[model samples]
Target chain A: MIENLKEIKKDELLSEVKKYADAKARFVTAVCNDLGDKLEVTYYFNASPGMEMSALRIAVGKDEEVPSLTGIYLTAVLIENEMKETFGLKVKDIAIDFGGHMFLAQDSPVLPMLKEKKEAAGEKGGE
Target chain B: MAPRTIAPFGPQHPVLPEPIQLKITYEDEKVVDVLPAIGYGHRGIEKACELNEYPKNIYLCERICGICSCIHGITYCEVVERLWPVEIPPRAKFLRTIWSEMSRTHSHLLWLGLLADAFGFESMFMQFWRIREKVLDLLEMTAGQRVTQSISVIGGVRRDLNGEQKKKCIEVLKEVRKESEALIGVLANDYTVKARTVGKGVLSKDQAIALGCAGPTLRASGVCEDCRMQKYQAYGDLEFEPIVETAGDSYARAVVRARETLQAIDLQLEALGKLPAGDINVSVKGNPPANEAIFRSEQPRGEVFYYAKGNGTRNLERLRVRTPTYANIPSLLVMLPGCELADVPIIALSIDPCISCTER
Candidate 1:
């Protein structure tokens, strides 16, 4: 159930996630999307005793960096490092920085997920 | 004082069947820090989802974790189902519940065997696996395959359980329960087992929550939270409390899983008895409306989070999975430090590490 999608300014990312942490919400996971010019990052927080997911989405320009949540929830380090490696998103102050080597091995394609690809040659685009 | 040393536990080891290496730094026999090197089993399953059509992605998801393959497919279907807003038939819901429970039973049994082997209990390990074989047989009898039963489709289950199969399932579950109970009793009372596990690799309740551990690992640390309690699928119709132990040690984690196996059996029986007669699947057609959905399920190890975004095409725009073991790995860093070098394998095994799930 994804009705709780809340958009946050990039600068407010850490403070907003901290509010959920203060309210005893469990940090579920973070997802990053490459939107060509900007990156859309969503951090999911789950409230217990019920099945509600609150997501905080932030859009960062290609040259910009987003604050890390490892200071708030230690578990965020792994996923953030993964985002750093996969989506090529820059995260500041990770609790344990694997140095862009969490899920992808060194010497693999850089930002493989965000690499540009041509659309299907002659297929109709999705409606 | 003895000299400090760095010992690599495994990228490959006898106790660990999966590919995960823990670079443990120790001061003599006491562990000072642990660096987990994963990605050995990464197959880019998430990226592969984009390459396949939305429907065919079910098979891809099922391959993410072979041990919990049924639930992986089920959760994937549920995520896609949310986009379409299709109602799975009552019988299909119950069947999903039953099969999910069966997967849980088999997974827990398999983990119990691996943990026993980690402790050098060879005979106990074999006994657990022997019981596990019967569960696999029950799965095969129903779904036509043992491991990686691709039963769940985009809408519902691909097969239905008949009366004869139901009766046989009950019989097999009863035998598994009996054998597992005897083994659990041995693990609980045996002095050597207790001496090895109790008060070892302790993770406090606060630390467990802060680290985002889930399922048995979180429950063992007295969090009393379970994704099952969220009541997705047939869990709402079932009755069971999250098995929690306050000790927050290796022994507590073992006990939580052993008891969860019994809970899974009870859940399967309850769902089977309440199975209703109806269509097993609804006819799902067309692309899901442009939308986003997140589905969470309680896997044997922990909570699995699936996110799907459809752009109204056959292929989903994005499909991301955050598996249980991925969340539980951080807790290993919390637990591993300060444990004795001898207890590293048992403590690591206690998390029921599934690198395939984590890396996928």
Candidate 2:
């Protein structure tokens, strides 16, 4: 229960993130947690140059896809691809999609970090 | 249109001895686009952290990056301490600050050595590393280990610095400063060194911030943002400013690191002079309370972000680490596309890519 963590809908991620970008707040990184029923993806930003920081917490359904922030911040490509590769969470239209091959090897277990790990997602996901 | 060819740069290369392959599209000599493939060294440390008890994770986190291990361990402990709402003694905070600065000094020297090696300056590389050995000796003398000190613990640091060790450390640091200045002067005045790095891999201030560059990479681009500005640990007790360079090129990055190596020494001297006297460690018991926390600490390369959610049990529900190298990779990707193919190594090395930390 950290203070200054704003709860927002998944659809608002882009617009809300744009506000941070407009405010010139640095795009820190996005963290995703598997909360059993849904994923709680939080976007963290340093609201001020010093210590003041804030996070936007959004709950996405287990199978839902979150829009990519790369459209607003080009650096989102790496972390977004990581969220796709490691968590097996869906991030659409990543500016530079590694086709989910950015990190994991071909023979590696799929979504090994996800709580409900799966091995068949990539063979099913578009290559 | 000139024909474009895509070439694989490395999971292994002479310049970068790490496992990061940059599949670069090149048109003649200039890079068209780059796609970096990592995880060759990924060990899934976050998942491992979840399996371990909260208190035992101090060592596990320290192994995230061998070069800057102390800060990772310290950051993890600090974040967990926040969860516990516990206050360590004043002396522990001071010890942590001294060790953290020492880690920074050694890590920056290591990076400068690597950068020197990238430019084929073998003698300079050895010289930089030779001075780095003194800083490492200070760590070994105080904490029992050179690279991965593992001094940080959940409640406080595991070791204390005696008066003899502190006095000797100060003397050694002064010598280290003198030796480093001789080489840093060469780096500043060497024409061949400047030609290779002066205008190479420039990331402007706005591009740097939008791309989310951290540490010297961001500061080199003229952004004055350092997590130490947050005044965590004993940092508030010291008076210093983050070193910034405006060119945002490879040379500026190198200069920032070289200057920071000196600044870190000054910081250690200040911390040692103002050493607070108190208990080093307080006994910590029980598991972290069931709550979430977000912690940020400035490491050698950049900022490290840690998110921990405790379940009131021994094991954490989630422990996510966003390392500096991981953040810097995106900026690397952006920096590579427009540069010459031959400049890739020094340009990429400018960000001080740490594959182990990035993958973890």
DockQ scores of all models, one per candidate: 0.49, 0.66
Q: Where is model 2 more than 4 Å wrong at Cα?
A: A118-127
Interface RMSD of each: 1.8, 1.5
* lDDT (Cα, tens digit) per residue for candidate 1, span B159-254: 999999999999989899999999989977889889989998899887887788888888898888877887877888888688899999999999
Decoy 2 TM-score against native: 0.96
Clash counts for the predictions, in order? 0, 0
Candidate 1: Cα lDDT at B141: 96
| Interface RMSD measured for model 1 | 1.8
Taken over the whole model, the C-alpha lDDT of each candidate is 0.87, 0.87
Model 1: DockQ score: 0.49
Model 2, residue B337: displacement in angstroms?
Answer: 2.5
* lDDT of each residue in B139-218, candidate 2, tens digit only: 99999999889998888999999999999999999999999998999988889889889899989888888888899999
Query: What is the model-wide C-alpha lDDT for candidate 1?
Result: 0.87
